[model samples]
Target: MFYDSYLYLVDGSYLPTVAPTGLKTDLGCWKYHFGAIEGMRQNGWTLWTVILIRLVAEEFNFKLSIMGQGDNQMLLIEFTETLPEEVTVNQVNQFISALEEKLSYIGPPLKIEETWISKDYLLYGKFPIKNRVALTTSWKKNCRMFRCCNEDFPTIETSLSSLAANLYAAVASDNVTQPIFFLSISDGHNQQFSLFLVIYQ
Candidate 1:
């Protein structure tokens, strides 16, 4: 009589196992690589992103991290964690998207512009002998062109670096101590809401 078995190393412990012939460790596995965390800390992910990842992982019992690509000098995040109850995969994906969007907006202030329906145009007769009609009356018409304002504008910044820049400007210069512009898009108003950051120097 003989016994056929196998062994698996988990957390530095070699445990005997008698399971299927082919075992896929990638699926439904708790992969905890300290090196991955260190790599993310040194390179790709910010402190906020790391904190957010930890928070999300703790809240949802998910394991995710930024892994380095072999010899490519690039890093990527591998998300392989089950979400909480009633949460869809898209919601989990939105976490990554939000991080990326925030990172992209970190460099400079974002300018928001309002698009106005300026005028309408009408076409009459055949294509070969068509005449263009420009409507100037205060009546309903089709949209032809959009007019964007260039005078007053708004800007948005959400990172600490931007805050530092604003603070530095207030201390270093007097001309930059005026109203800082910002904007927000509101669905209720169906327009761009201009916001001003008044720094009293």
Candidate 2:
């Protein structure tokens, strides 16, 4: 059995070609990849989801958006970063306001559904979201907040680069007796890089 998978990145970017099994005939094989495939039963492809993974820090901000119409819809935004030394009420207000404005632009009626802030190390105190009553109320109504420890999530670029490099390395090794190859492409002017790996048994 073979399968073709599509991984959509944070910036709504994706690689066009099939992955893993590299079969492009139909979506039937994908049932084994994503268990309980929703798009399969509907007779229409409706499973369009994007993963938002980022490392946030002081003066660091990122935005992501995905708009579509479907029965199974979900949008989640997460930021993992070290705790800053000091954060002002004004700063928090500004961040929330900007997030609200950005969410308004999404085509689907998608609510945040949840918002979480977790701390690690010697910080075990109440991180208040009550500074702005209106914003807090809106958040409370639309989002669920939670507290926990920080986790490390890979950025899309790092993940892609690592995957391409590893695949190339495996094919280039002496142990592989198969006639397989790969190409590392880079456009120096545009600062774009891509690795194409083709395998034949």
Candidate 3:
């Protein structure tokens, strides 16, 4: 759907090519331009509602933002839109539950916390292992797990790079006909997440 600043008012079924007149003269209109995702359900193309849940707070004129912190590590999302009225834990959980329902394939582990400042909430989330190249019916045992963290140098990037190279090396050594894969989770900083590299021969 194509729209100017009045995106909230546009009908979802309207095509982008049929943009109304004066659309080009509107200020801050370009920011509202959205493209349709190919696989989304019918009549459900809203960006915040369908994909980016973090920005949903904007619809209510509240503050919702994310940042990477803690020694250049860890992703933190803060929601601080509620004022005058108290924001309950149940409300936060309901919001998260809605997101989880939309993103169920993202795994089951999620952490949520509320700050003492009232109405401010923090959510810690992670992306699960995606089966990009193969079907992941179940996780196998005996997989090697590596943890490398807390370094004065660029440990996270180097570790991840080395992990990828090592997987290729292992595949070559074992003469495996199938593809070998590894999982990498980084908050883009000091903390190192669990890395599991498996070679299926």
Q: Candidate 2 on 1-201: residue-level lDDT in tens?
A: 113443233353433346576634343322335444445544233332222111112233433223333543222223335535344334444554554454456422224454333322111121232423211122221111111112254333544454344445544443432332222222211112221211111
Model 3 regions more than 4 Å off: 1-51, 55-61, 68-85, 105-201
- Clashes (N, CA, C under 3 Å) per candidate: 2, 0, 1
Q: Per-residue lDDT tens digits of candidate 3, residues 47-68?
A: 3233345533334333444443
Taking all chains together, each candidate's TM-score versus the true structure is 0.19, 0.20, 0.22
Q: Which candidate leads in TM-score?
A: 3
For each candidate, what is the lDDT? Answer: 0.33, 0.33, 0.39
Best-to-worst TM-score order: 3, 2, 1
lDDT of 2 at 2: 15
Position 132, candidate 1: lDDT: 42
Cα TM-score of candidate 1: 0.19
How far residue 184's Cα lies from its native spot in candidate 3, in Å, is: 35
Q: Quick one: RMSD of model 3?
A: 18.5
Q: CA shift at 50, candidate 3, in angstroms?
A: 11
